[model samples]
Target: MRRAVIALVITAAGLVPLLRYHPNTTTTAIRATAGTAQTPSASSKAPSTSGTRTVTGSEVDTEFGPYQVQVTFNGSTITDVQIVEAPSDRRSQRIAESAAPTLRQEALRAQSAKIDTVSGATITSEAYAQSMQAAIDAS
Candidate 1:
Protein backbone atom coordinates (compact mmCIF):
# COMPACT_ATOMS: atom_id res chain seq x y z
CA MET A 1 0.00 0.00 0.00
CA ARG A 2 2.82 2.39 0.90
CA ARG A 3 4.65 1.64 -2.34
CA ALA A 4 1.50 2.37 -4.35
CA VAL A 5 1.02 5.63 -2.48
CA ILE A 6 4.62 6.70 -3.21
CA ALA A 7 4.18 5.92 -6.87
CA LEU A 8 1.01 8.00 -6.96
CA VAL A 9 2.86 10.90 -5.34
CA ILE A 10 5.61 10.65 -7.88
CA THR A 11 3.17 10.62 -10.75
CA ALA A 12 1.29 13.56 -9.29
CA ALA A 13 4.53 15.51 -8.95
CA GLY A 14 5.41 14.84 -12.57
CA LEU A 15 1.99 15.98 -13.74
CA VAL A 16 2.16 19.26 -11.87
CA PRO A 17 4.54 20.91 -14.35
CA LEU A 18 2.39 19.84 -17.24
CA LEU A 19 -0.66 21.36 -15.62
CA ARG A 20 1.11 24.65 -15.03
CA TYR A 21 2.62 24.94 -18.52
CA HIS A 22 0.85 27.17 -21.00
CA PRO A 23 1.64 27.71 -24.63
CA ASN A 24 2.00 31.22 -25.99
CA THR A 25 -1.40 32.39 -27.22
CA THR A 26 -0.62 36.08 -27.57
CA THR A 27 -1.10 37.69 -30.97
CA THR A 28 -0.81 41.28 -32.24
CA ALA A 29 -2.26 43.04 -35.25
CA ILE A 30 -0.65 45.79 -37.34
CA ARG A 31 -1.92 47.31 -40.51
CA ALA A 32 -0.33 49.49 -43.19
CA THR A 33 -1.94 51.02 -46.21
CA ALA A 34 -0.84 49.69 -49.54
CA GLY A 35 1.21 51.87 -51.91
CA THR A 36 3.35 53.13 -49.11
CA ALA A 37 6.96 53.98 -49.94
CA GLN A 38 9.44 51.19 -49.53
CA THR A 39 11.35 51.17 -46.28
CA PRO A 40 15.05 50.98 -47.08
CA SER A 41 16.91 47.96 -45.77
CA ALA A 42 20.33 46.46 -46.38
CA SER A 43 18.71 43.48 -48.06
CA SER A 44 16.65 45.61 -50.43
CA LYS A 45 17.88 45.71 -53.98
CA ALA A 46 18.36 48.89 -55.94
CA PRO A 47 15.14 50.07 -57.53
CA SER A 48 14.96 49.75 -61.26
CA THR A 49 14.02 53.05 -62.93
CA SER A 50 12.76 51.95 -66.32
CA GLY A 51 9.02 51.36 -66.21
CA THR A 52 9.33 50.03 -62.68
CA ARG A 53 7.51 50.92 -59.49
CA THR A 54 7.73 49.74 -55.91
CA VAL A 55 4.77 49.07 -53.67
CA THR A 56 4.68 48.17 -50.01
CA GLY A 57 2.16 45.74 -48.64
CA SER A 58 0.09 45.93 -45.52
CA GLU A 59 1.67 44.53 -42.40
CA VAL A 60 0.21 41.26 -41.12
CA ASP A 61 0.39 40.22 -37.53
CA THR A 62 0.81 36.54 -36.63
CA GLU A 63 1.53 34.68 -33.47
CA PHE A 64 5.18 34.80 -34.35
CA GLY A 65 5.41 38.48 -35.31
CA PRO A 66 4.48 41.11 -37.85
CA TYR A 67 5.28 40.51 -41.52
CA GLN A 68 5.35 42.96 -44.38
CA VAL A 69 6.56 42.77 -47.98
CA GLN A 70 7.60 45.06 -50.76
CA VAL A 71 7.28 44.16 -54.41
CA THR A 72 8.77 45.83 -57.40
CA PHE A 73 7.01 45.66 -60.74
CA ASN A 74 8.47 46.35 -64.11
CA GLY A 75 5.49 47.31 -66.26
CA SER A 76 3.14 44.78 -64.66
CA THR A 77 5.75 42.04 -64.38
CA ILE A 78 6.96 41.22 -60.90
CA THR A 79 10.68 41.98 -60.83
CA ASP A 80 11.65 41.54 -57.19
CA VAL A 81 10.28 40.72 -53.79
CA GLN A 82 11.70 41.83 -50.45
CA ILE A 83 10.74 41.15 -46.89
CA VAL A 84 10.20 44.47 -45.21
CA GLU A 85 9.46 43.10 -41.76
CA ALA A 86 9.54 39.76 -39.99
CA PRO A 87 9.48 38.19 -36.58
CA SER A 88 12.39 39.14 -34.36
CA ASP A 89 12.37 36.25 -31.91
CA ARG A 90 15.28 33.85 -32.26
CA ARG A 91 13.32 30.84 -33.44
CA SER A 92 11.09 32.89 -35.70
CA GLN A 93 14.05 34.89 -37.04
CA ARG A 94 15.84 31.68 -37.97
CA ILE A 95 12.80 30.38 -39.76
CA ALA A 96 12.26 33.70 -41.56
CA GLU A 97 15.87 33.95 -42.61
CA SER A 98 15.77 30.52 -44.19
CA ALA A 99 12.32 30.89 -45.67
CA ALA A 100 12.43 34.46 -46.98
CA PRO A 101 14.71 33.79 -49.92
CA THR A 102 12.69 30.84 -51.12
CA LEU A 103 9.51 32.76 -50.66
CA ARG A 104 10.89 35.64 -52.71
CA GLN A 105 11.84 33.34 -55.54
CA GLU A 106 8.42 31.72 -55.51
CA ALA A 107 6.67 35.08 -55.55
CA LEU A 108 8.76 36.26 -58.46
CA ARG A 109 8.12 33.07 -60.40
CA ALA A 110 4.46 33.03 -59.62
CA GLN A 111 4.14 36.78 -60.27
CA SER A 112 1.45 36.80 -57.67
CA ALA A 113 0.84 35.91 -54.05
CA LYS A 114 -0.21 32.34 -54.83
CA ILE A 115 3.13 30.80 -53.92
CA ASP A 116 3.48 27.58 -51.95
CA THR A 117 4.08 27.80 -48.24
CA VAL A 118 7.63 27.12 -47.07
CA SER A 119 8.20 24.02 -45.00
CA GLY A 120 8.48 24.67 -41.24
CA ALA A 121 7.51 28.30 -41.80
CA THR A 122 3.83 27.98 -42.45
CA ILE A 123 2.77 30.96 -40.37
CA THR A 124 5.40 33.25 -41.83
CA SER A 125 4.56 32.05 -45.32
CA GLU A 126 0.89 32.79 -44.95
CA ALA A 127 1.52 36.23 -43.57
CA TYR A 128 3.98 36.91 -46.35
CA ALA A 129 1.51 35.84 -49.01
CA GLN A 130 -1.23 37.92 -47.50
CA SER A 131 0.95 41.02 -47.48
CA MET A 132 2.27 40.34 -50.96
CA GLN A 133 -1.21 39.97 -52.33
CA ALA A 134 -2.19 43.24 -50.78
CA ALA A 135 0.77 44.94 -52.44
CA ILE A 136 -0.01 43.39 -55.79
CA ASP A 137 -3.58 44.43 -55.57
CA ALA A 138 -2.55 47.95 -54.74
CA SER A 139 -0.13 48.11 -57.61
Candidate 2:
Protein backbone atom coordinates (compact mmCIF):
# COMPACT_ATOMS: atom_id res chain seq x y z
CA MET A 1 0.00 0.00 0.00
CA ARG A 2 2.84 2.45 0.79
CA ARG A 3 4.60 1.71 -2.53
CA ALA A 4 1.31 2.20 -4.40
CA VAL A 5 0.78 5.52 -2.61
CA ILE A 6 4.28 6.68 -3.53
CA ALA A 7 3.76 5.70 -7.17
CA LEU A 8 0.45 7.56 -7.21
CA VAL A 9 2.06 10.68 -5.78
CA ILE A 10 4.85 10.60 -8.34
CA THR A 11 2.40 10.14 -11.16
CA ALA A 12 0.28 13.01 -9.88
CA ALA A 13 3.36 15.19 -9.53
CA GLY A 14 4.42 14.50 -13.09
CA LEU A 15 0.94 15.29 -14.38
CA VAL A 16 0.79 18.58 -12.47
CA PRO A 17 3.59 20.01 -14.53
CA LEU A 18 2.23 18.57 -17.70
CA LEU A 19 -1.13 20.14 -17.07
CA ARG A 20 0.37 23.46 -16.03
CA TYR A 21 2.70 23.65 -19.04
CA HIS A 22 0.61 25.37 -21.68
CA PRO A 23 1.77 24.68 -25.22
CA ASN A 24 -0.66 27.11 -26.83
CA THR A 25 -0.92 24.73 -29.73
CA THR A 26 -3.81 26.51 -31.34
CA THR A 27 -2.07 29.87 -31.45
CA THR A 28 1.13 28.31 -32.71
CA ALA A 29 -0.68 26.49 -35.50
CA ILE A 30 -2.61 29.58 -36.47
CA ARG A 31 0.56 31.62 -36.60
CA ALA A 32 2.44 29.06 -38.67
CA THR A 33 -0.44 28.56 -41.06
CA ALA A 34 -0.99 32.29 -41.37
CA GLY A 35 2.67 32.74 -42.25
CA THR A 36 2.77 30.02 -44.89
CA ALA A 37 -0.62 30.88 -46.31
CA GLN A 38 0.28 34.48 -47.22
CA THR A 39 3.61 34.07 -48.98
CA PRO A 40 3.22 34.57 -52.74
CA SER A 41 4.71 32.19 -55.23
CA ALA A 42 7.08 33.39 -57.96
CA SER A 43 4.62 32.55 -60.71
CA SER A 44 1.97 35.06 -59.59
CA LYS A 45 3.49 37.96 -61.46
CA ALA A 46 1.47 41.12 -61.68
CA PRO A 47 -0.20 41.98 -64.93
CA SER A 48 1.79 44.27 -67.20
CA THR A 49 -1.21 46.02 -68.70
CA SER A 50 -3.46 48.61 -67.09
CA GLY A 51 -7.18 47.97 -67.18
CA THR A 52 -9.97 47.33 -64.65
CA ARG A 53 -12.33 44.34 -64.74
CA THR A 54 -14.88 42.71 -62.45
CA VAL A 55 -16.24 39.21 -61.81
CA THR A 56 -18.83 37.76 -59.46
CA GLY A 57 -19.63 34.18 -58.37
CA SER A 58 -21.52 32.19 -55.73
CA GLU A 59 -20.85 28.90 -53.94
CA VAL A 60 -23.52 26.57 -52.57
CA ASP A 61 -23.64 23.43 -50.34
CA THR A 62 -20.57 24.36 -48.36
CA GLU A 63 -20.06 23.27 -44.73
CA PHE A 64 -21.42 26.61 -43.73
CA GLY A 65 -23.98 27.26 -46.48
CA PRO A 66 -24.38 29.42 -49.56
CA TYR A 67 -22.00 32.34 -50.04
CA GLN A 68 -21.52 34.98 -52.69
CA VAL A 69 -18.23 36.54 -53.74
CA GLN A 70 -17.33 39.32 -56.09
CA VAL A 71 -13.84 39.83 -57.42
CA THR A 72 -12.29 42.73 -59.18
CA PHE A 73 -9.77 41.77 -61.80
CA ASN A 74 -7.25 44.02 -63.37
CA GLY A 75 -6.21 42.80 -66.79
CA SER A 76 -5.66 39.04 -66.30
CA THR A 77 -5.12 39.15 -62.56
CA ILE A 78 -7.49 39.18 -59.63
CA THR A 79 -7.03 42.41 -57.70
CA ASP A 80 -9.61 42.19 -54.94
CA VAL A 81 -12.65 40.33 -53.65
CA GLN A 82 -15.73 41.68 -51.97
CA ILE A 83 -17.41 39.31 -49.55
CA VAL A 84 -21.11 39.62 -50.12
CA GLU A 85 -22.12 36.96 -47.63
CA ALA A 86 -20.46 34.58 -45.17
CA PRO A 87 -21.35 31.90 -42.62
CA SER A 88 -23.44 32.90 -39.60
CA ASP A 89 -21.47 31.41 -36.69
CA ARG A 90 -18.80 33.34 -34.84
CA ARG A 91 -16.21 30.65 -35.39
CA SER A 92 -17.09 30.51 -39.05
CA GLN A 93 -16.87 34.27 -39.23
CA ARG A 94 -13.43 34.23 -37.66
CA ILE A 95 -12.39 31.47 -39.99
CA ALA A 96 -13.70 33.44 -42.92
CA GLU A 97 -11.66 36.45 -41.92
CA SER A 98 -8.51 34.42 -41.39
CA ALA A 99 -8.97 32.60 -44.69
CA ALA A 100 -9.23 35.74 -46.79
CA PRO A 101 -5.51 36.32 -46.89
CA THR A 102 -4.81 32.71 -47.77
CA LEU A 103 -7.38 32.72 -50.53
CA ARG A 104 -6.17 36.01 -51.91
CA GLN A 105 -2.59 34.85 -51.88
CA GLU A 106 -3.51 31.70 -53.75
CA ALA A 107 -5.47 33.68 -56.27
CA LEU A 108 -2.46 35.86 -56.81
CA ARG A 109 -0.21 32.82 -57.16
CA ALA A 110 -1.98 30.08 -59.12
CA GLN A 111 -5.19 31.99 -59.95
CA SER A 112 -7.35 29.03 -58.91
CA ALA A 113 -8.54 26.66 -56.14
CA LYS A 114 -5.40 24.55 -56.57
CA ILE A 115 -3.93 26.27 -53.54
CA ASP A 116 -3.55 24.36 -50.28
CA THR A 117 -6.10 24.57 -47.51
CA VAL A 118 -5.28 26.35 -44.29
CA SER A 119 -4.25 23.93 -41.55
CA GLY A 120 -6.90 23.34 -38.83
CA ALA A 121 -9.51 25.27 -40.80
CA THR A 122 -10.65 22.72 -43.35
CA ILE A 123 -14.31 23.68 -43.48
CA THR A 124 -13.48 27.35 -43.53
CA SER A 125 -10.90 26.70 -46.21
CA GLU A 126 -13.47 24.99 -48.37
CA ALA A 127 -15.81 27.87 -47.95
CA TYR A 128 -13.04 30.26 -48.95
CA ALA A 129 -12.11 28.17 -51.97
CA GLN A 130 -15.66 27.96 -53.18
CA SER A 131 -16.19 31.67 -52.79
CA MET A 132 -12.94 32.34 -54.59
CA GLN A 133 -13.91 30.00 -57.40
CA ALA A 134 -17.10 31.95 -57.81
CA ALA A 135 -15.15 35.16 -58.06
CA ILE A 136 -12.78 33.67 -60.58
CA ASP A 137 -15.65 32.38 -62.66
CA ALA A 138 -17.26 35.77 -62.65
CA SER A 139 -14.01 37.37 -63.76
Best by lDDT: 1
Best by TM-score: 1
**After superposition on all CA atoms, what RMSD does each candidate show versus the true structure?**
5.3, 11.9
Error of 2 at 9 (Å): 28
lDDT of 2 at 139: 43
Clashing pairs in 2: none
lDDT of 2 at 69: 58
1-139 per-residue lDDT for model 2 (tens digits)? 9999999999999999989974522321111111212222233234333467555555434545445556666766677765556667676678777876776677668767566888866765665566566555444
**CA lDDT of 43 in candidate 1?**
30
Model 2 spans > 4 angstroms off: 1-50
Candidate 2 lDDT for residue 44: 27
Task: List, residue by residue over 1-139, the lDDT tens digit for candidate 1.
Answer: 9999999999999999999986877654444434453453333344433477778888887876788888888877888988878878888888888999999999988989999999999988888898898777767
TM-score for each of the candidates: 0.69, 0.55
Instruction: List the lowest-lDDT window of 10 residues for candidate 1.
Output: 40-49
